[model samples]
Target chain A: MRITIIGSGNVATHLAAAFKNGGHRIVQVYSREIQNAALLAYHVKAEAIDRLQDIDPETDLFVIAVKDDAIFSLGLSLAPYKKLTVHTSGATALTVLSSIMPNSGVLYPLQTLSKNKEVDFLNVPLCIEGPDEQTTRILEQLAQTISNKVYRINSAQRKVLHLAAVFACNFPNYLYEVARRLLDKQNIDFELIRPLILETAQKVQENLPVEVQTGPAVRNDENTMKMHLQMLQDEPGLQMIYELLSQGIIKNTKDGH
Target chain B: MRITIIGSGNVATHLAAAFKNGGHRIVQVYSREIQNAALLAYHVKAEAIDRLQDIDPETDLFVIAVKDDAIFSLGLSLAPYKKLTVHTSGATALTVLSSIMPNSGVLYPLQTLSKNKEVDFLNVPLCIEGPDEQTTRILEQLAQTISNKVYRINSAQRKVLHLAAVFACNFPNYLYEVARRLLDKQNIDFELIRPLILETAQKVQENLPVEVQTGPAVRNDENTMKMHLQMLQDEPGLQMIYELLSQGIIKNTKDGH
Candidate 1:
């Protein structure tokens, strides 16, 4: 299968390499930044197209891996090609490409990607959606070649999944940063909490997080909670977050699960 | 080293086993619940004592692994023996035990403990603080036998570490639970986001979490944020949380990593 990748960012670079390694031909690479396009294209042995008009019309799939706002304009720009174009976005709708092309889909890889870090595509779950049955089947097969887990999720379900991913992934890291900051405030090394963090994650994988919950909030230890609040008196913003999250945990736990 | 455990709950059970495994003698086990004391004593090969007067003063260390409220009272009760005593609490001050015994300290394990789970104490950071140098040294040696990561954290620092663990471990699980609840509302399987959660955690461990931050929040994608808000219309409490967290992330990222 021949593929043309739009956008030369982390997601685009990683996906392009994964596809190339999976025995698919990368026909072209596009980026608003010419240097980024050239850099990724050099690796995949593809033409670096700075403009959308320079895209190869002959490729089997055109993956628009650009920013969310750029998806519509890029889809419209690639309308003439009329191939099975897809956008690798978790939140974008499949209909965004409907007016631009009759055959389009989504190939959202549900994993955090970085250009330098090599991604094990087989471990990444691909949430995909297509306009028709044939295209959906093709996308499923394509995703299966690169990933072990493939789900036929539509735009609505994908949006919810993306929202959940934010909570499960992004927000947790933010909390981690907050934890690190708190530790740093006391001239203490944050590395002390790494094992605890890793074990917390490992426990959730084996069982539901709610069942395995511990700490002051779960136990409703008011004395410790008060002590923590007193410690966070300086950082009112962090104090608010601490209180909100504690309350959230208490509310959830009280909701009978 | 002769040790007597003053609690029979999760922390006490795990610490007793770890001490026994580290080749120390558990001389006695005390608990408000007679059966709990008997059960833990049998495993640790220690005498079960319900009365404080029954405590053997010959023991080198009386490890108080009881609840926060019980610490003060229990310390007072054990004052008759006046053996080297330490309360395993993150929030409680070292002075709480000092009032009861001449040689008292803290043996707080900076990790979440549950009755069902067995933890590898070798890496769990033990935060030790004592009134005297000799007592501190002895406690440090005892902590080192079980854990590689031992720290001389004060009562204030221990409280901070405990608070940080809540953010890194407890609150993150609650956030995951929120996501799970959202999935349940839409009849979507919560399992779909597991890979994303796992990868997010892995990425943060490999790099600074701030470097790997991604999502509508970090990107400051207002349109997506609005859509998310609309989707969560029925859940006012969750909507508020989402707004605050999203705004917080945006603010944190804007300040530059």
Candidate 2:
């Protein structure tokens, strides 16, 4: 399949390569910054364009793999390309593209894409939604070429999934930061928590996390919680997070019981 | 070393088996409940006792690996065996044990230990703290037998480390639960998020997490955040968490910039 990637960020760079690896043609790479566009286009053997007006209309799929805020503007820019266009975003609505393009859909790869790291697109769940059935089918087939798991998720469901991803991936990473800072304050190496973090994540593959929940908060050991709160007096923000989350967990446990 | 495990919890069971694997003899196991004691003792090749009066003073180290609240009481019960006691807790002060023993120390294995899952003590950080120089040296040597990394962390530092583990391990696991429930609401398999979660975690090892942070929250995409809040109106508690954490991340980013 012929493709035009409309972004030069991490998602666009990674996806362009993955598509190329999957035996698809990357015909063009677009970016507001000419250097970024040229960088990705160089790797994919494609044309680099700073302006969307320069986009080749002959491409089979136009992927608006830019930031959430830029999707609408990008769609408007690519309005002349009546070809199938999709954005690689979880939170943005499919209508954002359909509002401009005659043929539009979503080709959201449900994974955190980074330029430094090459992701296994085959494992990523590609969420596809479209303005019409034909475009949806084409987008679905396109996604299935790179990924084994494909889902027909509408805007509402996709938004929920995106929100859930925030809790699962983004919030947890912040929690890790908090942990690292706490340990660093006491001259403790953050590496010490690596094994524990990995094990905690691994447990979810085998068991329901609620069933496997352990620690002072879930157990409602008030004494340990009190001591931790006292220790965290210097970090009022973290203390607020700890207190709220613990109360939430305890309330959840009681409701379960 | 003739080790007597004075608890039948997850930490006690893992430590007893690890010691046994390291060719040390587990003399006995003690618990408030006889069944709990017997279950662990059977695995460690030791006798089980329900009463404190039944404790034999012949063991080299009487490990008070009980709950945080029970440590002081259990230590008081074994006060006669003064100079031969230790507790495996990062949060509790060594003085809690010293009040009941002439020699006492900490042998905190820095990992989240679960009863069902087996742990490789060799990789777990053993944070050892003792009252006197000789006792500290002996404890360090004992720790070296099970783990490659051993630190002489005082009570103040160990408590901080414990608090850090709560953020790293416990809080992340809780966030995972929140994600699972949110996905469940949309009839999306929570498993779809697994690869993303794994990749998010793997990224930290390769790059500085703050540099690699990408999400609607991290991007400060107010439009997406507002839409998510509207979608999550039914889940007020989760909504609050999402809003507050996003605010915190945005604040951090502003400061960073």
- Tell me the TM-score of each prediction against the true structure: 0.95, 0.95
**A1-257 per-residue lDDT for model 2 (tens digits):** 89999999888988898899889999999999999999999999999999867878888888888889888887887777677788988888888888776888998888887787777778888889988898789888878888898989998888888888898888887787777777777777777777777777777777667766777898798999999999888878778888878887898798893
Q: What lDDT score goes with residue B129 in model 2?
A: 95
Residue-level lDDT tens digits of model 1 in A172-253: 9888888888888888887888777777776677677787788888778888888888888987877777888889888767
Candidate 2 residue runs with Cα over 4 Å from true position? A131-134
Candidate 1: interface RMSD in Å? Answer: 1.4
> i-RMS, every candidate?
1.4, 1.4
lDDT of 1 by residue, B1-257 (tens): 99999999889998999999999999999987889999999999999988877888889888999879889998888777768889998878899989768989999988877777778888788899989899899889989998898899988888788888888988888888888878787788877777777776777666777888888898788888998899889988778778878877998998996
**TM-score result, candidate 1:** 0.95
DockQ of 1: 0.71
The Cα local distance difference test for each model comes to 0.86, 0.84
State in Å the error of residue A125, model 1. Answer: 1.4
Single out the weakest 10-residue window by summed lDDT for candidate 2 chain A: A203-212
The stretch of ten residues in a row with the least summed lDDT in candidate 1 chain A is: A111-120
